[model samples]
Target: MEFDKNFKTHSFRATFITDLLKEVPIHIAKDIVGHEVVSSTEIYYRSSLTKKDSLKILNSVDTLRFN
Candidate 1:
């Protein structure tokens, strides 16, 4: 599929880091990117998750079962 013209190589990095944040600890994600601080890597997670994305994440949690 053709991505947007605005898409750049850094976009892939951001997406990868964002996905990593969903599955792994912040420290691990930061290490993977060779960042000195977890806060640096967290920028990708925060920016990638917009208001609409936040709602989608909450909606996905509705399907889970808990004790």
Candidate 2:
């Protein structure tokens, strides 16, 4: 068995950190990734939200009926 050029250690690291960031806080993600600086982790997981995407999230929030 052989791996291709797309297979790199950093790819796995990037994916692992990216998935972790989605569920956990940035500080925790930074600790899991073992970065001394949170900025580095922020660079990996920062996503730009489109207007439509923002509206969807806001609409979801508005639909919540708190007791």
Give the TM-score of each candidate. Answer: 0.58, 0.61
Query: What is the clash count for each candidate, in the order shown?
Result: 0, 0
Candidate 2's C-alpha runs over 4 A off are 46-55, 58-67
lDDT of 2 by residue, 1-67 (tens): 8899688887677778878978999898898888999998876764557889999998888888551
Per-residue lDDT of model 1, residues 1-65, tens digit only: 98889989887888899888888888999999999997888777745568998898887887564
Q: For model 2, what is the alpha-carbon lDDT of residue 22?
A: 81
Minimum summed lDDT over a 10-residue window in model 1 is located at 58-67
Whole-model alpha-carbon lDDT for candidate 1: 0.82
TM-score of model 2 vs. true structure: 0.61
- Compared with the true structure, all predictions reach lDDT values of 0.82, 0.82
Runs in model 1 deviating more than 4 A are 1-4, 46-67
Number of the predicted model whose TM-score against the real structure is largest: 2
Per-residue error for 27 in candidate 1, Å, reads: 0.6
